[model samples]
Target: MGRKNISDQRRGEIIISFYEVSRSLGLENASIAKLAQHMGISKGLVLHYFKNREELLLGLNEYILEQHLRVMVSEDIGKMDCKEHVIHFIENLFTRAWNTYFDDGVFYSCYALVYRVPEFKESFKAYLIQLHEVLYKKLEEAVAFDVIVATDLKELTEVIFALIDGAYYYLGMYNEHDLAYKQQIAIYVKYSLRLLDFRS
Candidate 1:
């Protein structure tokens, strides 16, 4: 692997290929050789853009975060009603697309690495904090519009994130066929709405 400049498109291709290979091969087992082969690029080229596995993983994490924001938060926050915005946030978190976007194995591998690697720990922690901030902002908007009556923004933000994370983890552990999965998600959504004191 030599130092060479790569186009942003090439870098994105490598990141995506890394994700595809890692998902199939398991992140720990997915070697740079496999990633290079998957992308049909030379190993040196992969290294040219990402100096090492740690750098690649961090880049992948950033890519995942950006993709999530694009897909899950497409609507302008100021344009939607408070209730609609709140529902949007919940639906995106529990949706099948969300599961696909963060494939169970790859997502958990990243999660586990956060605890073991100090550098990854900070990057992953920042990602979670950003997620909380986004949710908190939406909740604040909801309160302003009287969508949830009155609420404690900080406490409610923690509760909401916990509920979503718990349900997502539960569903991942017991991933079933589409029908059963949908049923479970429906139940989760209902319960989450109840927590927000949300009414039709």
Candidate 2:
């Protein structure tokens, strides 16, 4: 690869390391020196890429949001009828993606921090709004196709996302092994469908 490409790749690696370290250890405890040591690189190299801790953290937050959106939009949830789409959506959010992306507990930690840290709150809210829009569109298409019963698509989408987030937060807090998480999520999915009066 070109030098620029190599440098970019290294920077990406450093950012990821920073995120992981910060997630495991609180932001206050995760320092540049520790991150560099964890990555087996010098602190100067980390600074060479990020300039400072704030810049590195900003990049990490942006990277996490982008990764989350990528996962949310990856599947063709709009292709299925409303019921099928809802089922698939729940499966993706509560089963597959949740198990993969959030199993480490870092995402929830960052989410909690966003509430306290003024720096991350705006960006986090923006990401949430974008995700809500995508989900609302999918639900609207489902309602139009008669896959689900008539309901407010935007409201329902927000409720579903909130429920998913709540479930994941609890799972991360109490059930890290994910043993009973699937069953709990299934219950919530069924309850949500009933609220929408979905026949299927």
lDDT of each: 0.77, 0.73
lDDT of 1 at 20: 87
Candidate 2 at residue 105, lDDT? 51
Q: How displaced is residue 9 in candidate 1, in Å?
A: 3.5
How well is each residue in 1-200 modelled by candidate 1, as lDDT tens digits?
A: 23234477778888888888888999998788999988787899889888998988987787667766554565543432567777767776776566546677888888899888899889888888888887777776677677876677788889878987888788875656668888888887777777786535
Any residue pairs clashing in model 2, and if so which?
none
**RMSD vs true structure, all candidates:** 3.8, 3.4
The numbered model that scores best in lDDT is: 1
Choose the strongest candidate by TM-score: 1
**Where is model 2 more than 4 Å wrong at Cα?**
1-8, 23-27, 74-78, 102-104, 173-180, 197-200
Relative to the true structure, candidate 1 reaches a TM of 0.82
Per-residue CA lDDT of model 2 for 32-127, tens digit only, reads 999998899899989999889867767777777777776676666546464666677656666546444532455655667676778778777887
C-alpha TM-scores of all predictions: 0.82, 0.77
